[model samples]
Target: MSRNRTRFLKEFPKAISDENAAVFIGAGVSVGAGYPSWKELLREIGDELGVKSDDVYDLAALAQWSVSDTGGATRIRQVIRDQIAVDHDIPAPLNILARMPIRHLWTTNYDRLIERALLAIRRPCSVISAQGDLALKVTAGAARVYKMHGTVDQLDEIVISTDDYELFRSRRGAFLPLLQAHLSSFSMLFLGLSFTDPNLRHVLSLIRESFTDAPPAHFAIVRPPQKGDFRSAEEFEARLAQHNLWAKDLQRYGLFAIEIEDYDEVPGLLAEVERRVARNRVWISGSWPLDEATTPEVSFVHDVAERVGGVVGSSGLTLVSGSGLLVGSGSMSGFLSSLQKTGAWDLERRLIVRPFPQPIEGGEPDRAQWDLLRAELARLAGHVVFIGGLKAEAGALVDSSGVHAERAIAQAKGAYLLPIGATGGAAATIAAELIGSDLRFDGPDALRPSDEQLASLGDASVGAAELANRVLKILKSRML
Candidate 1:
């Protein structure tokens, strides 16, 4: 199980990096956001109808029974509305999921927590919550959310009754086929789902039935059956056996389960995956007014930036470019040249240029907003490179505050620091501070920067090509 978990943690992020990832969320994720689980929601309905929730094993049947007693779905809908109407906080795991590179989200939950999380990150989302929405087009690069079950807002159409389940494919139109298509193609992560939904099982069965031995690989995060969850040793053992078989059955359908000890470990697992995905993405920090300086040192700095960018591209890593005058162009050119050498000249593929919004409309430049922008971008990088970060102030050069801010942000986000100290200004100062305080070096030995190479980064005499090669070596040493 540990090996399977390791495999998922290692390779799933690559699916995201390759833009072939999708996520299927469930009621469990909404449970973390203060909403009731299926059992809890059933309990509420059970109490309403003088029925004990514990008497039923099939949750959908329990919901259908409530609908039957009401003579319509109205009372059941009211119960649902009253039970989960509170404003809920977006949980940590969901926030992390939103920040990931994944663009597709499929969920059976009725709540808007997923949308809210994406909205928090300002990710434009196209939500397909009902049959009619299937006709809509998902904008390029926009997040796509498929709410398979009807949302709580449309209470009359919500799928809680057996009749609704039976008629889902007919009533909901192509939802089942659409889900099946996605499941067949994308590398999906199943989060918080019980795998008990008849609709989901149908899709899984279709995928399995049409399989050619090697199906599209998928993953799920599940909690292993706990001994404390059952009454007797026999009961616990049976539950454990059942859990193991269920895990094995999922593998038959191509979903490898990664069992965690507890649900509380979810956020940490997600954070680690995010970190792993961010590695290999190099974000260079620092800016210089190349037009204002004619010194040979400045020329050396520009050369170093371009050389490093080329290595980053040739090594199959990404360059997250900054908009600093000369340095940005130099690095972009180098990155493009690397792409051209490989017969792939698409800059958009190898380079990321996320420009920041300048000064606020009414007042001075928004420092806080700029910091937020910088932090957001830094989170997407596994390493930060600093070089010639200086700005002209009162006819003299001073350290760029933005560069220093980026180092702090990158450090907090676990980004590797690769400062070219020979270029001087903010980068040199940062390198000096880092070396003197051993701040960035205070990590596991394997993950730490090489002491000899670290010193060369700050050496004024280090050549641009050597510095770039050193940077490549350091980057490779940390690849896990």
Candidate 2:
């Protein structure tokens, strides 16, 4: 990777983690999901007017011309409705983005694909499509999507004509100031977004005049002009030179432009960002059987889980786990205790505690549904820690299938494994694999568990707190 790309991969995730990052989307993003591009939307009007798309450089002017030619805005609006009504399956790039913990999403497109993608990932979003909607914030648990140009649901208020661009300030009035504030406050990632739009160009000028110093760093993912993009060789050469100049100009506003070969590579780049952001997120997967009396092994496992949870919470790592039988509460209590001792109040943001769905109708639980849930939760972590993996079945203790399934899912997703062998049950076999059979841990050499740490984990003499400290050392080494 280039230095710029590596730097962005490492730093952008941290920006998102610190709540200092935002995403600015464009029509190109939705185009991948079968939405009409500006050219495609205007092509219908162009056909009626006997004009060609190749000849037109400004699409907003084409829209205005169509409005003038028809002597009304009815046909234009209907065409827009028809163009936007076409929907397809969500693209991979959007899905990857939805999985991240982004707070602010800005878009110039009229489609609801952004919010729809977020909702599909189980994240509800408050959309600011108009100035009045800006005050309606979802304070409880939702991200905000700013549809600056307007949305398809409200056809009359959409911004598409040349007049709308020229008079955006007086009409919308509130968006520019808010946008300026956001640009000054957060690092914005421009995905499939360009600076050529009249509204954005106007805001850029406003921001330039508003700030005496350079604005905060921003970025754009752009497709550079290629040789075959145009039929004429001279045209391609000219546009390529223009793109080079455009890249340099972007630095004036502290916007770094990253060029890629194709749009398909976008999902991979986003997955890298997702991986970097989730390194500090730890997922606990285990259960304790409640059949008969709690054995000495069960007690040891429960103690270890609690101490592990306390280490996770106190050290600023986000905890994700399902409410397994007896072990889940121990971890939850330890995490809550740590938060209470530190006087931190952001429990909702710091933890994701999902209760496993109870079995219905059948005596046995649905393996498929549980599999789906475990996969979703494990995707949010860079490390998986297993302990006390036991369940009650036929009134007897047995190794937990959930723990083994979680281990498979986590391993496939390339997470670092930390299983306590001293707790025995399902975790013992897995830990034995680490000691002699296989090296399942996926992390840097500096963060790798030493033989001493692994042996101490399985040793009968090692106490609960000491084992938890060893695990914390590996997790915190990533930060170092």
Candidate 3:
């Protein structure tokens, strides 16, 4: 990763945890969801007026010309409703945005892509297009999206054409002040926006004038102009130079640029941000057969859990585990007791057990309930550590513990996995599988267990301290 990206990954988690984070979206994000870019929208309008689309640089002016030629905004409104009012499903990138914990979203787009995305994820969002909407009391657990340019739902209020841009201060009323407040109060991540939007430029200018000192630092994800897209190398270099200059100028408004190679990288970066923000939570999964427990295997599970609990207690990372009768409760109970002895047991922060729903009469949980619990654990944890369990019982295709570990690995997407094969059984099988396969773990290469290490994991002599040390090493390396 580049230095800027590293810095972002390291710092953004704290911002999210503090509830000081916000996102400012632009047309580029909506374009990916089937909407046209500002240039494209204006160029199409210009084409209708016998103007060469490529020759028109001032999109607002072009919009004004089209409205003037038609003698009303009816045709322009129709064009906007036809072009910007997309009813398609939200794209992956937008879905990531929808799932983010940030409660505030500011967009210059006129479409409902952002709102629709939030809806898709079942995240209730209060839309703010007019000043009156801001006066309405905010609902708890709902995100607030401030449409700075207006939305397609209200055509007359949309900020397009040179006239609207010129009259923005008077027409938008208190919207600018509310925007200024958010800019000062929150650490913002700017997405899918070019810094050149005249409306955005005006807002930044207002913010700059209001604050004597620098406001909270903000970030803008920018794509460097591609070399292959330009007609000539010289043209590409010139465009890059201009972009760099613009990036530098943005510092005056306390905005830093996170330059990326392409737009496709945006979703991945956002997903990583979400992952790192939840990094302090670790999940422990495994199930040993109580009737056939070996002394060494039992000793290994308790030792690993004890060491992990000590580390988690001291470092403030929460331990999220299942409530399985065998491995889950047996291991974690000892882990908690160890923490209590060290004055590190805090129920609110140190431990979280997502228990499987049980029958009222007291029997093994139904398959559906067990599966649901596994899914929840996978969703909650940033890292999962699998210990020892049976590989299979009788004619079963696979051990239930191994299946749960696999489900977690798949569902968590980028979660860190540490399978201690030394403990043997299902964990050893998982370790062997991972080491033998071609899949890459999502972290520094040094953090991943080597082939030689995997081969040694099945050894019965490896103690709990050593296994604990290995898991700690991976976690600490990632923090660095």
Best by TM-score: 1
User: What value does the lDDT take at residue 245 in candidate 2?
Assistant: 90
lDDT string for model 1 (1-480, tens) is 787789897788877776778998877788877898777777878888787876666777878887788787777788788876666999998899999878889988888888889999889888888898888877777888988887776777677778887888789856767777777778889888654443456456655755555556789898877889778999889878877888888888888899888889999999888888888688877788655668887888889889988988888887896666767777877888898899866565457787665565565776777887788778888888888898888888899887888888888877878788888889888777666555545343222365566688877675899888888888876654
Which of candidates 1 and 2 reaches a greater lDDT?
1
Worst 10 contiguous positions by lDDT, candidate 3: 439-448
Q: Could you tell me how far off, in angstroms, the CA of residue 452 lies in candidate 2 after the best superposition?
A: 6.2
For model 3, the stretches where C-alpha displacement exceeds 4 angstroms are 44-56, 64-72, 166-173, 206-216, 227-240, 271-275, 288-310, 318-355, 359-380, 387-399, 402-414, 420-425, 428-473
Clashes of 3: 2
TM-score of 1: 0.90
Worst 10 residues of 2 by lDDT: 440-449
lDDT, model 1: 0.79
Which residues of candidate 1, in runs, are more than 4 Å off? Answer: 48-50, 195-203, 206-212, 231-234, 343-350, 356-364, 393-395, 436-448, 459-462
Q: For residues 164-196, what per-residue lDDT tens digits would candidate 3 score against the true structure?
A: 888888888678777778788888888886744
Answer with 1 or 3, whichever has the higher TM-score.
1
Among all windows of 10 consecutive residues in model 1, the one with the lowest summed lDDT is: 439-448
lDDT of 3 at 247: 81
Report the backbone clash tally of model 2: 0
Ranking by TM-score: 1, 2, 3
TM-score of each: 0.90, 0.89, 0.75
